[model samples]
Target: MDLSLSTRTEGERTVVVVGGEIDVYTAPKLREQLIDLVSSGQYHLVVDMEGVEFLDSTGLGVLVGGLKRVRAHEGSLRLVCTQERILKIFRITGLTKVFPIHASVEEAVAATD
Candidate 1:
């Protein structure tokens, strides 16, 4: 499936809502968006992944890379993921400790503040 990314700013945070499968092919799109946001000086980024139906290792790597970039700039990266399978992957990889995973976008936005 084709990947789509939508950006929105909530207060001081930039939220990127990602939809569709996030695999080797579509991971680059997400990486590009993250880089754009970081380069634009928007350090506080929240990735809303509720619309994502599938995620692979490449997708996870993109997220980890984004987190590192944000931290390097003294910013933060949060994730909004409601998918059980995805959550399991994060938990297994110990990314749940690395990233603040929220149940909804509202929660993530609130945490950013």
Candidate 2:
């Protein structure tokens, strides 16, 4: 399936609502969006993945890259994903330690410090 990405502001965070599948073909779209957001000076990001139907290693890499981009500006990249299937990828890759995953956008946004 195709990927869908939308961005909005909540408090001090820019919430990127992601839906559909994130595979090799679609991961780059996400990566570009993240880069644009960060380059535009919006660093505190909360990626809401509740609508994600599937995720692959490329998607994980994009997330990690985004995290790094934000961190370079002393910013943060948080995730909102409660899907067990998608969460398993992070767990398996030990990214659970690298990123803060939240159950909801509200929780993720509030988690920004």
Candidate 3:
């Protein structure tokens, strides 16, 4: 699937709904959107990845960079990922310890520091 992204504010959190593959080719798009949001002073992001069909190392790098950027501003970045395949990548790479992953967007948005 082709990459797609849409953002909406939910209370104080920005929900970014992502669809399609996130690989070397599409990772830059995700990275740019994230940088724009953070640079614009809109942090508290919840990335809903339910529609994501595939994610590669490049995508993981982008997410890690996003986390660093948010942390620099004392902000937070959460994720919503229900796919076992995707979740397994996080586990294998030890990113499960780095990010707060929820099964639903609502749950991820509700999580607080």
What TM-score does candidate 2 get on C-alpha atoms?
A: 0.98
Please report, as a residue range, the 10-residue window in candidate 3 with the lowest summed lDDT: 104-113
lDDT per residue as tens, model 1, 5-88 = 999999989999999999999999899999999999999999999999899889999999999999989999999998999899
**Candidate 2 Cα misplacement greater than 4 A, ranges:** none
TM per model? 0.96, 0.98, 0.98
1 against 2, candidate with superior lDDT: 2
Off by over 4 Å in 1: none
Q: How far does residue 98 in candidate 3 sit from its true spot (Å)? A: 0.1
| Ten residues in sequence with the least summed lDDT for candidate 1 | 104-113
Tell me how far the alpha carbon of residue 56 in candidate 3 is from the true structure, in angstroms, after superposition.
Answer: 0.5
lDDT of each: 0.93, 0.95, 0.95
Model 3, 10-101: lDDT tens digits are: 99999999999999999999999999999999879999999999999899999999999999999999999999999999999999999999
lDDT of 3: 0.95
RMSD of 3: 0.6
